[model samples]
Target: MTKELKESDPGSPSPNVLRIILALRKWGWGSFWSQLVLAIIASIILIATIPFVTRAAAPNPNVPIATAPSPGIGMGILFTVIGIGIVYFTAFWSFRYTKLAQKLRGANGGERPSKLQTVKLLKTGAIFSLIGMPVTLIGANAIVGALTIKSLTPQPTGGYVGVISVQPIDMFVVQASILTILAHFVSLFASLWLLNRVSDKPTN
Candidate 1:
């Protein structure tokens, strides 16, 4: 007796869509793992730099080190690198989510998404990522500046320094911190929504 073979549905995804989806799925894992690893590395670097900063700030009679200016610059570079790393990670996650959505649609045997759909996902993700960038930069600068200021003018020995004046830049930094927190929540929501949409699709 001859055996019957089952064929895939004619309405299933075309070769092009299937190929695109497979490519996107492959990229999703790469993007996620790379971003995660980079974020971890950034955190480690930032943490390790703290000791260098502290050593630079300490007063030492035996060693000839510029105790005043070095710590501030070191800290500034560290924070800036950290901020950039965070932004890059967030952007990677956003891009991954968008790709995952496309892949899900393809896997579900649905028609390939249009250019507009792709653009919309990217635009929404990018907007959130951009919003956080300035906040991160400002906070990092503020931290470096504050550290520098404290290091530069040490309190007089056996004498008290007068009340420190709050600068406009300080206020800007404070506001930026607040904004950063808000932007983080927004980005989180966007990421979750994108992920949820992808997961909800019926997969093959």
Candidate 2:
């Protein structure tokens, strides 16, 4: 009796292609969700920290200028740094699927990923990371800008201005910043999902 040919069978498909498919299927979902949860938790904590940060950084009307960074400002900075770090960490974790592919090919015995595969995976995560990075920085800056506004010298006016001192422009910036940060997170998720899907495919 003749044996049935399989898409996974030796001589039926490229051996490396079969290994990559197996590795991606094994690692994709678990790797994605774990990192995703971490990113979300970190982001929420960072968001929660914002109010305290803005309150702390609120400039005193009496002070001519900010003498030094406020504690809240420092904490905000720390959180922003952490958020960015988490993004990079997640991207790197997603990138690990490639390694799993190599291992599936028995790289433990010294096999290597095809140059094309390696380059493709590397580019996917990297491009997303680069794309999100600017938005992250912008969001961080917006929060800092909003918090520091209290320090600005109030503009002299003949007529009474609104009681609320926070400028509409500042609030707009902050709102936009929130969207930008969320966009970065969503983009990161999409990038990881794409990496998983793309790596599993038999195509180049």
Estimate every model's Cα lDDT from 0 to 1: 0.50, 0.50
- Per-residue CA lDDT of model 1 for 1-204, tens digit only, reads 001111265655544445434444544444455545544554554555555556656777664332232434554554455454555657476566545555445545566666456546545655656665665666566665764565565444426554334334333333434434343444555544444443443554
TM-scores of the models, in the order given: 0.45, 0.38
RMSD of 1: 11.4
Winning candidate number (TM-score): 1
Candidate No. with top lDDT: 2
Q: What value does the lDDT take at residue 62 in candidate 2?
A: 62
Off-target runs (Cα >4 Å) in candidate 1 are 1-7, 66-69, 81-85, 88-95, 98-103, 106-115, 124-204
TM-score of 1: 0.45
Which tens-of-lDDT digit does each residue in 1-204 have in candidate 2? 012213444434355456544545455444455556555555555565455446547766664233323333443355355545656465465647646564545435665556466547645654766665574675567466646655453544446432224444344334434544553455455555545555665555
Off by over 4 Å in 2: 1-12, 59-118, 123-204
Backbone clash tally (model 2): 0
